[model samples]
Target: MVAQYPGMWSGRDDGATLWGKLAHDRFRYMAGIYKVHNWIDGGSGSGHNPLFAGRIEYNFLDPEPSPAYYTASTYYGKAHILAIGLAGQYQVNGVGSALQKGDYKAWNVDGLFEKRIGTKARYDVYTLEAAYYQYRTDGVCDIASSFNNHKADYGNIGGINSGTAILVSTAYLIPWRVGWGRIQPLLRYQQFRFAHHLYGPGNPKTRQFDAGANYVMDGHNLRFTFDFARYTPASGTQSDAFLLGMQMQY
Candidate 1:
């Protein structure tokens, strides 16, 4: 096992990892002018489930812009998903080999798209995203699930095959005014799939609903969001999980 997961470097700037490097100005063509800001996601459970992503936004379709609410022939904004990275499942005890055992590998290849419709008062937004993930499965020596659960799988956590996964999601955004600025609410649906040859290879399907608010503050935007998911195994299992997150971008 090498020392690191993706290693200090993957050799090629754009190797096979799948993380795309796109820019936000790419969306401005449609909204006349839009801004892409940088921000971070932090909270108590932050490191518990680590995720790093670079996103950009562009405003296209707006004809005239003079500060005031000017309605062009059409007002629509586009958001480009530059890159997405994630830290897989965290296992308290497992393998010392980077991704071969303990802790899920932080697979990086991912892509996403976003769109906004309407002017200042009300608008509808939609986003589509996809990613491939390969998490860590407990080694044969471990007597519990790779997720650090109580039960043990006889299949030995499923080996390198355990981490392979494909995920996709779609979301909707609705913006409204509160006191001084505006608040945007978001809803999303997601799906995850296992490549069939992994450990314990069970087919688990999930339904998700996420809601969040975005507030603008002097060129800086602050957001808070919550997500809920219901899982239905393709075979025989019933369970549910939910997550919450907050973001700040300017």
Candidate 2:
């Protein structure tokens, strides 16, 4: 089981320090029809790899297109979440690392349906969703000398959680818009029962919360936002609390 050397490998900088998506809060909120997208491109200035060099990119386009390469666009029909987007990928040759898997062109789609409970009039703020797929592209099925490393969890079957589910979720949104801006709070409860080592044994269910304020400008159709989050799990393992960060949309 020894490869002679042990070191952590990295491909893309999707997120490391940030608190990540506050599923407790809607990443975006609007009543009417709209189109949206977001992108974040960053790299490490430190941590030179023991054998490989770190990344320096000219644009959001990286030599390794990993999970960080995502497109967020939504299409809603009568207060429902209908959007489809997938992250494609490009792998470096012979390395077994997706040094630049930019979104799978084979499975690539813009986004998919994201639905809430009711229509905009009633402001039904709760919803649940998931996506699954499986394909063989001649990629390695072994990692750490094991095919089990590819097992799926959360109701997905086989190497792809394509048919099974290990979890169910509940969501909530409380929002208000005033003359100055808009404010919203979000919450999510995730339940996982499938017994898999992917998330570890005795994997506890999860609960998360996010709160934010948006400065809405009608003239240019701009919304500037600041948010924070605190997560307490039904089965405590990785709980967190932090001032999330920021974003702007129109």
lDDT of 2 by residue, 22-107 (tens): 13322321111111001111111112221211211111111111122232222111235533323222212211223321111112
Choose the strongest candidate by lDDT: 1
Q: Model 2, residue 195: displacement in angstroms?
A: 14
lDDT of 2: 0.28
Q: After superposition, how far is residue 46 of candidate 2 from its true place, in Å?
A: 19
Residue 112, candidate 1: Cα error in Å is 2.0
Error of 1 at 166 (Å): 3.0
lDDT (CA) for every model shown? 0.35, 0.28
RMSD after CA superposition, every candidate:
13.2, 15.3
Whose TM-score is greatest here?
A: 1
Q: How does each model score on TM-score? A: 0.40, 0.32
| lDDT score at residue 10, model 2, on the 0-100 scale | 20
Kindly report which residue stretches of model 1 are placed more than 4 angstroms away from their true locations once superposed. 1-109, 118-125, 134-163, 190-198, 201-221, 232-250
The alpha-carbon deviation from the true structure for residue 151 of candidate 2, after best TM-score superposition, in angstroms, is 32
Candidate 2 runs further than 4 Å off: 1-70, 73-80, 84-176, 188-239
- Number of colliding residue pairs in model 1: 11
